[model samples]
Target: MTLRIHFTGEDLARTHIAPQPDVLWETMLSLYRLRRREQTLVFGEWKKTALGRVPGSVRMLTTLVPVRGYTVDFLTPRAEPGSVAGGMEALRRTTGERLRGDMAELLARHPGKRLPGWAERLAAGCPDALDALVGAVDGYFHACLSPYWPHVRAQVDRERARRARLLSAGGWEAVFSTLHPSARWSFPVLELSYPADHDIHLGGRGLLLQPSFFCRQTPITLRDPHLPPILVYPIEHDLDWARGQAPDRRTTLTGLLGATRTRVLETLAEGDCTTTELARRLGVPPSTASRQATTLREAGLVNSHRLGQAVLHTITDLGVAVLGGRWSGLIA
Candidate 1:
């Protein structure tokens, strides 16, 4: 089945990519990965580590976020972007009517399922019940999500950078077309492969493209069409992302590209930047930064595009490979 998202010109114009991963969204989606045993190649190591010390929140979250179904939107209230504390505060502030409605809708989807007493109290807007829920989720996040968040944030940030490059080179159309293999851009409608068939018409509310580390397979959005639309999709992962430590072989890269060029590549890996910004960071003349960036571009290790007065440079896949010490000696 496909999830068809209809977009008007205003909607397209207003569409934007999130700067970072949403802590609440990723935390919620990770539960799906945890409950399911699939994707062992991608999530296996992290799962082993996370499950080693099971917090009570694990059991509670698993119940609410069923392995394959809808979860209450209140649990993932639109917080201050990527802040966990902000998300918890937003969650706590959820009105009783909204919580009850969201929880009821979630249970309706599951049919026979029933909330526990605490969950029931949560639906009734009981302060203590909400506090317990928040504490449990916070504990789970500290134990599981916090440990590997740097990796998660890096992956999401890289994906956001890639999308920005694509947007710079092409437009919203290009972004939608290349969003993922599972998605298709047909004029104003973006079609996504989803578990069920549905349509979300964005009546000028726009959409937020959220890159997630734990979200896998297909993209997902809120069940309620009235809510602010957000499409949470999994970004491509580094095989070593979930592994404990990232490889550090800057000395080897320095030997190959020299110290200045090596530093340029490393900086670009962090994000796309202009030659001026690069020069500022490198504390060199604009001409020098331009020359080094040109060399990296010539070697097929970087991608640069012009934007008004500044030239934007991004690290290509090969650049990343070379910088990360996973590159072969040959450039071509």
Candidate 2:
């Protein structure tokens, strides 16, 4: 089975690469990976730790995300590029009409497949059902994803940087040509090997390319094409990424700039990011991160710019030089 995506010249020009992973999508797919025994080799430690700690409230999520086939579209809304809380809020506010329609389609497609009571209540727009579902998603993230998110995020940032370099050096054709082995770019069409045979005519809506640490083997797309077209493909990882943690290699830099400031600089070096994202990555208070970033900007080691609601920070050439040859060799 193959998914043939028809692209226009406008589509090519409009295509976007997400700066970070979608929290809801990543949590939903990670659950799918957890349920499968075949993923043991890839997520061994995570599975071992997460299985025993699965909260009773979130256990019902197992019913919603099956090991195979479709999951409800409302669970992973792509309204905007925002935090996990924003995504969950969107899920909670899924219109009754939309929820029921999606559920009806799911039932019709699967014939006699059994759905949990929560699914029925959710379809009917019960408030408690929505709360319970949101709780489950939150609890699941706390149990399985939060502990290792920094490491996962770092790997994702690395992949994004690599792709950005590709885009700069060789244009869209080069980027698409090496996107993934399963994805083939041949002129006006981009072909993806998938579990179902389908075609999407991106009538100038363009496509969003997202890299994921959990997505493996095949790229995934939303069932409905009318929604913004997004392709979530796996990012390559090494043994360190698989270990679910990043080593503390900033000791030398920490000596130069206090620990917190060094961390701020290191995080900025990964890629351009918002103050909020920097704080989250460093596990520091947002105000503290902002202060540190301001200090760096004043010293001419970082540059800050505003894009909509976000204040993005990027390392300056002097900042890279300050990181010196040793740190450069380590990340390289």
Candidate 3:
């Protein structure tokens, strides 16, 4: 089965990449992966840990996300650059009407199925059901992903930067060609090998290319074609990438850079932030924060961009590498 996306001139013009991972989407996909036990090499440990941490009540939430089948669309909100908490907040706010409609659609797609009790409650717009579902998701994330989020974000950022560079050098052609092995670009049509066969005509709505850390092999698209078009593809990573070892050399880096600068780098790895925000987060003087950022920027470990009156500092690829204790160059 293949998904062929027909693109127009406007579609080509509007097609763009997302700057960060969609937390809700990732969480939903991770649950699917854990249920399917797919990519055991990468997710085995995480799956074990997540399942162990999942409460008895929350275990029912897994039934909603089958190994292969329709999962509700509202489970994942639109992609935005930020923490998973923001995504959870969106999930919590899903309107009862929309939830019921999506749940109805899910059940309708799979005929002769008995709806899980929790799902039934959720579809009925029960507040308790919503809270329970959200709690389960949060518990799963804390158990499985929070510990490794820094490493995950680093890899995602590096991939985004690489693709951005590709876009700059050769436009969309280079990007599409290098996107993934499963995605084939032929003229105005982009063919994606999917579980279901369908054609999505991007009637000038374009598409959003989102790289996912948990998505493996096959890329996923939004089931509702009428909604915004999005393609969630797996980001490439080595075996050790999932293992997430920062090396023993971090102690040396900490000693050299002092605790405050090291904390700044660690915090920046989560996401970009202004110097003032960084200072407030770390409880340091704004001048001290500025000096540290300047030092890190001069070292080529961090990059700062002026966004209006505030300058946002983000960890560069080298910076991520250094945080992993892989960089052996001079600390000064």
Candidate 4:
């Protein structure tokens, strides 16, 4: 079956890339991924590490987000630009009407389906139930994704850089065509491989393109078409990240590149960044970041490209060799 998303010219014009990964969306989607043993190369180690670490609170919460089909939207707020704390705050403020409506719709999808006691209570919009939901989400995120967050953010950033290149080359249509093997860009509609066939009309609301590290296989969207439109797709992974955090090689890098320069390289290695982004990350002045990026680019440790008004800087393959991961383990 195909999920057809119809877009208007206004929709296309207003469509925007999410500036950062949506924390709650990833958290909610991961519940499905954690239940099954799939994609061993990408998720095996992470699942193994998280299998035992999942807290009881989250385990109870998982009943609402089953292994497949129809998860409640109230559990995951809008993929706004902010921190996890911000997302949790949004969940905490979910109105009683919305809580009742979302859960009723979810249960309606599988008539006569019985949820756990707490989950049923959640459907009733009990205040305590919302509290429990927030707690469980916090526990799940901390246990499963917190440690690997930097790596997760890095993967999302890598996708952003790649999409930026595609946009620079061929515009929005190119982005939709190559978004994933399952997706096809055909004129006014974006078709996706999905379990169910349905139509989501943009109605000029536009769409938010959100890249997720934990999203696997197929892309997903909110079941309620009345809400703001969002497309959450899995991003390409770096197999090296599955090995867990390596021993710090900062000492070695500092010896070769000095403290600030070494930090610059490390930051770029994590994700491609504009000079302003690099500066913001490093807490340094823009001019200082630019100069350092120039030095690194001149030394062939980084590549700088003019994408629009910003110079996007990415670590070169040689720089990858120096930091070490995909090419080989830490530099000797």
lDDT leaderboard ranking: 1, 4, 2, 3
Q: Which number leads on lDDT?
A: 1
Supply the global lDDT for candidate 1.
0.81
Q: TM-score-based ranking, best first? A: 1, 4, 2, 3
Worst 10 residues of 3 by lDDT: 323-332
Question: What's every prediction's RMSD, in angstroms?
Answer: 6.8, 11.9, 11.2, 8.7
| Pick by lDDT: 1 or 4, better one | 1
Candidate-wise lDDT, in order: 0.81, 0.76, 0.76, 0.79
lDDT of 2 by residue, 237-327 (tens): 5434445333444447677688788878878777767889898999988899899999999987777755446676767545655675544
TM-score of each: 0.77, 0.73, 0.71, 0.75
Q: What is candidate 3's TM-score against the reference?
A: 0.71
**Model 1 Cα lDDT, one tens digit per residue, 1-332:** 99999999999888999987898888899888887978998788888898886696667677678888888887777889778898789878888998799889988999999778888898899999888888878888999899788777777877787888778756886678666677788878999899889889999989999988889889888888888898888776655556644355656877888989988987887767889999999899999999999999999888776555667787765576565643311111
lDDT of 3 by residue, 157-230 (tens): 66687667556645787678667767677879988789889788899999898888888878888787887898
TM-score of 2: 0.73
User: Global CA lDDT of candidate 4, please?
Assistant: 0.79
Error of 1 at 167 (Å): 0.6
The alpha-carbon lDDT assigned to residue 90 of candidate 2 equals: 82
Error of 2 at 36 (Å): 0.8
